[model samples]
Target: MSLARTLLDSAATTALVATMALSAPSARADEKVSIMVGGYEKQIYLPAKLTEALGYFKDEGLDVELLNEPAGVDAENEMLAGAVQGVVGFYDHCIDLQAKGKFVESIVQFSQAPGEVELVSTKHPEIKSPADFKGMSLGVTGLGSSTNFLTEYLAVKNGLKLGDFTSVPVGAGTTFIAAMQQDKIQAGMTTEPTITRLLKTGEASVLIDMRTMEGTKAALGGTYPAASLYMQTDWVEAHKDIVQKLANAFVKTQKFINTHSGAEIADKMPQDYYVGDKEGYVKALDAGKAMFTPDGIMPEGGPET
Candidate 1:
């Protein structure tokens, strides 16, 4: 089978990456492979962070460095600039760049669905659904980003044209919270921890939650592949073993997260990722745990659905 097909069909096992000893040495054993991720703390990309925290790359004899960029496209740009070997970003990017003739390939699929939720500030009881979105200011991660895409999709799904509601780019972390706290936006698209924090403060409530695959399918009308490890097709071709090793670690990490408790998994993550409330952070993580694919493969018809 072709490498791409091999990876796409990796749902059954993870032995593919262990063939490092048989690999042609395109990269030195000590070479550091930099992976740029959209956001480090969002629960959607937790497995990527978990792979790093558990020393999975080191254990596999691969030196992988994961850099965080709040906007996923920024991480993709970093890969294009030769600053990173791979980008852990939304799977739609592979299709986007492919259309532009760049032909990026997703080697490891992370989440089967977009782990985002539409939140409306408690102050605006009148703004309940997208029907009420007309003339309201909605928040997204950034213009032309995944969060923005979801926001736009939501707008269209509600039978209102894109411009009926204005989308302002309010980021995912603290910025997302501040937008709600200060009432800068009536509704916004954000991910976990931020979503969890908003509810804890009683300032925001879930207008549309897509943290679960079922919720994502219901909200987007299909499965929207969220996070994955992707790079230029040429890059993967040249560094097959290195890429495979990284994929192996992530597949293992996903399994670890599935079998473990949220608090135990959170313990492996950076302390700063927490919402300053341990219980809430764990609760958020638990809510989001089901989003990760067990074998690190995108589900059949994942992007299409």
Candidate 2:
């Protein structure tokens, strides 16, 4: 779900939230926080769903509105516009913005790895390697997204320039599937459910897989810090108490995931989140469980890696 805009071979990914919602806690809450997740129902960002399902936010006296925005940029813009309290997105984004002289801070971590795989369209049988991507149309979530950065990184690793291949902006889930069916993109990188669906349909095959920690270390030379909860430093500074409470809730959630099965966790989430494929969802969820951190804290030097 995350690849930093810039390259860092040894960096690890943290959890991200880019959601917005309006809900009440069991008790009277003192404040309301809006969180936006870049993608909903994908394995990469399942921690947020799990957290909500377990009612950890309510337990901590927080009224959270969990909203889903497909584009991380849009979610970030929401934060910039002060429409949301926090964003669950690629941790690299904090670094990306800081480099531009704006400071964004990650408060809680969800995953330590990029929970996605690179895929090649079955129709493009002639393309057998990353080097063959030259002159091909690859798909990304958007122009400045993690997938986009990974595409550029892979091309450069394969002796091709960042612009060697074309990158088409393809949204996740059904839209992504449709793009492949229409031959709009020859290959792309995406998270579970979508990746699992394509493989099950015999439309695409795995290219580079960072869903595993070993693969992550091998591919980018370190953790890429995929999903994380972040906000502008000013927000974090002004709301330390609320931020602490939020962290406490999410930390409890991480522990909850550690003690439960993926099936159990998925069952708590909305039934439609699986899109009517419970078995597939569980299978995909199980495969990526190891990618998540059992605590809400970002490891020391993890972001700088």
Measured by lDDT, the strongest candidate is: 1
Q: Estimate each model's TM-score.
A: 0.89, 0.89
- lDDT per model vs. reference: 0.78, 0.78
C-alpha lDDT of candidate 1 relative to the true structure: 0.78
Tens-place lDDT digits, model 1, residues 275-300: 58778889888878888877776677
**lDDT tens readout by residue for model 2, 1-305:** 13343323222212222111112123445889999999987778887877888888888788899899887777888898899989988887777776776667777777878887888999998878789999999988877877787788888988998668898889788888899889999998888889888998899998889897778888888766678788787887788667766777777777777788889888798888787688998998888888877776565445655
| Clash count per candidate | 2, 26
Q: What is the C-alpha RMSD of each candidate to the true structure, in Å?
A: 4.1, 5.4
